[model samples]
Target: MKRRAHLAGLLALPMFWLIGIYIFSLVMLLVTAFWTTDPFTSKVKPGFTLRNFEQLVANPAYLSTAVRTLVIALAVTVLCMLISVPLGIFMAKIAKPWLRALLAVAITLPLWAGYLVKILAMRVTFTDAGFFNWALAPFGITGPSFSITTVVLTLTYLWLPYMAVPVYTAIRQLPANLFDASADLGAGAWRTIRTIVLPLIKPAIIAGSIFTFSLSLGDYIAAKFVGGSTQMIGSIIASNINLNPPIAAAFAVVPIAFVVIYLLSVQRTGALERM
Candidate 1:
């Protein structure tokens, strides 16, 4: 009884800290959202109102930018899944341990080499006279410059490894006997995969998708650097922070909402228990 109580108290400590930070931040935002600056005095007036949300809703540009962020985030998430799923299966199901290990290392090592520098390298190759265009110039394939495409591609490169790692681990942990049993029962490769493998690995897919979506949504640096005029929620919040704290708070909360909902769904699905 005493042990249970002590453990409960210990667990409560971090939860308390997290709750305190969230509540404190929310309160500050509520206060600042209502604050009015005196015209002549340049002093802040502590009050309450709904001007921030009203302004956010009324501004078409803000709404459009938010939509663009969600669209791009969805695109990135889908692309990561499409790329990682096959790669993870190949790496996990390969007959040789050395081959699997080499592929795993290849997929993972580039992640630690600094993401910003990778974005810069991508930018360098896309320049008109850069290597990519230089190679294509001889083939007479030229077109207008692209910034949005560059940003999306850069983010995909950055997050593909994150998606691959989890899916690979999930696939590797799956029982080898299950595959053999299915084959012995005259199940084809695709049939075995569809019936036995997919359900087991769905949890990993969920995890990887959550990571890819959340990271891409919350990321400020990549959106700001590669995204040029492609305004996203991150930059929107940044712009509003000093000038309009309440609205910025609202913008930041959207991503937090996504993360919380995803976490709750994962918990309900017992997805993380396997991890």
Candidate 2:
């Protein structure tokens, strides 16, 4: 009884905050999604209606923006996976102890810097006379103008550490003897990675992907800075929030639904258990 009481005491404050504040806000937002706002008065009038959702479904621009955001999110995840896997392997399996430590620091350094600063830096880099174009001039390759390609590249840059760190940790946790055993059986390095390492690291990759996908899905600031006129679901929500909150709420639910569905899919793959 005493131990149970103590445990409950420890959980009391956080539970109150989560349930009372966080969950309560989410409930309010979802409830508001079914509500209507008065156009003449510009005020939220609470009543049940599915019209907001219908509008979301019917709007061609909204549909395109949602599709565009989804594509960007998937691209970010794929790009992160491609970059992180081999880099993770090198950091975990090949680097000397000092080199590993240095690499870890290098990987984590960007996260310590402000996100806005990094985005701004990328903005400068992609400009016509910026370092990217200047460096590529000799190769006759033009820098990507402010476009979807730039958005993908910037997002991938921002989220790479999130994927790489977790993957590196997973690879490092793997037993060294597994590699030795695979090699003893005459499996080459590529074969061992495909048959052995890939299976074991699948969970960690999925874990990292959760962060990359969800963040990319909701990002508005990066898109605004580098996307030119391109708009994401978040940008649309921000635009409509004060004027038509119900519509914003309705749109807000899309990414949440996408994330929930994604998590469910990943759950079925059993990758979450590894995390």
Candidate 3:
């Protein structure tokens, strides 16, 4: 009882800080999404109003930007899963400790570098003299530059580790008996992956996909330097921040609301899984 009381006291301030800082800020945002701002007075009205939200819903530009973001986010999610699943399963299957460690470093080295620098490196490396165009010459797949492909590839590289690490963790956690059981049941390597491996990592895939998708969706610098005039939601929101703070707030609220609902669905699915 005494130790319990001591731990409770230790946790009290952290809990308070989490609520006051993060939760309260989210609540304030939800409030501000409705709180009207007067252009002349520069004062935000306290009462609820949907003018900001309606403006976002009515405008095709904002709607298109959001749709584009979702499309890009989903593409990134698929690519991350495609890469991470095999990489993670391979890491988990590797028996030697030093070899696994080397593989892990190779996987995460890209993430260790700064995001801006990574994108810039990609940008410079994609020019006519850059590796991308040079490598593509034989294939005849040439383009001006910074196409949707560039944005997708840049975002994918940026968030690759985020997906990889989680998936590796999840795969490593799987029981060894599951694989042995599958083999004993006459399942081939492909069948084992299709049935046993993929199902086991569904939670990790979903979690990592969400994280990577959110990161790509919210990335501004990559979209700016490499994806110029692509008009991603991140750039749009950044543009609106100073000029239309409330509208920006509204834009912020939508993604927040989306993630909250998504997280809730994940939680519910997890609970069902537990049951």
Q: Score every model by TM-score.
A: 0.82, 0.97, 0.87
TM-score of 3: 0.87
Flag the better candidate by TM-score, 1 or 3.
Answer: 3
Give the local distance difference test score of model 1. Answer: 0.76
Superposition error at 251 for model 2 (Å): 0.4
Global lDDT of model 3: 0.82
Segments of candidate 1 deviating more than 4 angstroms: 1-5, 26-31, 34-45, 135-145, 259-275
Model 3 regions lying over 4 Å from their true place: 1-8, 37-48, 94-97, 271-275
RMSD (Å) per prediction = 3.3, 1.1, 2.8
lDDT of 2: 0.94
Error of 2 at 15 (Å): 1.4
Name the candidate that leads on TM-score. Answer: 2
Clashes within 3 Å, all models in order? 0, 0, 0
Candidate 2's residue-wise lDDT over 73-137, tens digit each?
99999999999999999999999999999999999999999999999999999988999999999
